[model samples]
Target chain A: MFDSHGFHQTAMAELAVAAQVSVGQIYRLFKSKEDIIEALVHDDADQWCGEMAEIQMRMDAGELTIVETFEQLLLHTIDEKDEALSFDILAESFRNAAVADTIGTMCQRFRTYIRYFACAANDKLSGEALDAAEEMILACLFGLGHRSLSRPRLSASSAARLTAEMIVTALGGVR
Target chain B: MFDSHGFHQTAMAELAVAAQVSVGQIYRLFKSKEDIIEALVHDDADQWCGEMAEIQMRMDAGELTIVETFEQLLLHTIDEKDEALSFDILAESFRNAAVADTIGTMCQRFRTYIRYFACAANDKLSGEALDAAEEMILACLFGLGHRSLSRPRLSASSAARLTAEMIVTALGGVR
Candidate 1:
């Protein structure tokens, strides 16, 4: 209900009806609609951060290329239906401060991971090159995700692979 | 008012006050709020199409590279305050059927322009290569616009130039 209808549009009455519970039951679990969304945001952030950690570990163990590690992480995140719903809410988080803060934090964490990976991939590249590469990869991932929502013909795995190729190609120019 | 507050938040009374007219006067000009937004979307589409046509003419005259022409056109469109407002409204148009239809039509026109330029620029490339180039450029433009909204330090012109260079380098396998 919250995925299709926005946070503001999902009323307590509708939620109660959908859950087969009284409005009081809703209040017991959530203080307000904002609380529900905030909880969702936190849960998603934790999951994303965990994925980033796992990818980093794989990279450290020489089990994955920086590109492959990041692509796998992103593909896994987007492939989950619940994760996709959470992502939609986060994208629309521009309308809500709590959601925006959560998203901003997650983005920062993701960038940190990218920076670390870029440094590991090539220590000689200047900070600006690394920043640009990270920016491009991040943009490609989320942009492709948003595009895929409407253009279902483009699979998430394909988009992730393309993003990985672009990033690797860009990084090859760093030297 | 509608641009910032959204359609539901902007009452007819508020709009009438902004226009220095009675609430009834608004109904006289348009049947409903949706009607007013529809008119705005129509005007926006026409303006963008006109600008795109001018760009095409310049490109045909050898005044710019295909990538440069498209980037300039997009940068100019995003710089227009009215167009930005229209973009914001169109972002929400997913919730409105009529607005969605208008936006879809406008997007189709833009895609056609991209296809034409991509084909012209990469005349020797295979169909798949041309399609990849087109999608890469489009993704860059989308990313640049969305990023610029949050980080105004990156001017549209610089972003456009960087995006063009990135696309050309990526497609030519220079990087």
Candidate 2:
């Protein structure tokens, strides 16, 4: 419901309609809109963790380079549903600590995965160096995701090329 | 109104109430909700262009490095209202050609500004090389902006340090 109508636009009545539940039933379960949002973020986080676990395997096997993984992540961020939900959660996180914690946890999970592969590739990429590189790569991924929305016509190939180069630079010229 | 409630959540009735006008008045001004959004995006683009002009002067005066300018831009993306509105507009652009055009124009303006400084710094940093650097820097800026939303406690100083380092790397170590 939040994905379809956005978190702010998804009123309890609308949610009840979408979920095939009585309004009274919703109140019986979730305390408020915030409560529903919190639960949703938790649910999404659990699923994302599952996805990350698989990605970790690929990272270890060298099935996909970090740049390729980031490209895929960026593309996911551009998805209409994913981007909207993410933007809403991120915007709400500014005012809601529960949401903030959820996002922070998700970010840490992603960074850990990236760091795992990055360290394996270059032993020197650790500590603050690792953190900085991860941050840059993540930022680039996030930026491209946002760009996907504003510029639907934005060339994925061009973005991919520049981002790959950026990842190399951030990784201290390791490819 | 879009900034506060997002594009979809901000209804005509609420806009009338906020703008101190009748719903009829709004309908007369804009044929539909899409028209209103289109107008808003275009108006915002004009204002953003003016800001870029000022930044260009500062760039010429050597008052701040491109990294510093980017830091300020990154921080603007972190602004609760600014980021929300931008995210909303960028998201809307995906579905609306008018919004997409406005955003493309806005992006071109910002890129031109960055290209000017970049070329002045490194005559070789023109064409594809400059385009690549600006894209990376913009992506980094955009990424940090989203980070600010997700991590409310993220320190500006730390973000600045990492981003400045990123700018140097993106410019091919041109600092």
Among the numbered candidates, top TM-score falls to: 1
State the C-alpha RMSD over the true interface residues for candidate 1, after superposing those residues: 4.6
lDDT of 2 by residue, A66-136 (tens): 66665555555444256656666666765567777877877777677666755754578755566666666
| lDDT tens digits, residue span B1-175, model 1 | 7645545567888999999999988999998888888888788768877877788889999998866875675576446453234444544565667767766676666667766766565566445455444555555555555553233334556555554544444555512
Misplaced by over 4 Å in model 1 are A20-31, A65-98, A117-124, A148-157, B20-32, B52-97, B117-121, B148-160
Model 2 lDDT tens row, B1-175: 6666666767889989989999999999998777876777677667766776776778679886766766655555544246666666555554567777867776776677666755654566655556666666667766776665344233656565655655665566432
Evaluated at residue B86, the lDDT of candidate 2 is 64
Whole-model Cα lDDT of every candidate shown, in order: 0.62, 0.65
Query: How many steric clashes does model 2 contain?
Result: 0
Tell me each candidate's i-RMS in Å.
4.6, 3.8
lDDT for residue B99 in candidate 1, whole number 0-100 = 69
TM-score of each: 0.75, 0.73
Report per-candidate DockQ.
0.25, 0.33
TM-score for chain A, prediction 1: 0.80
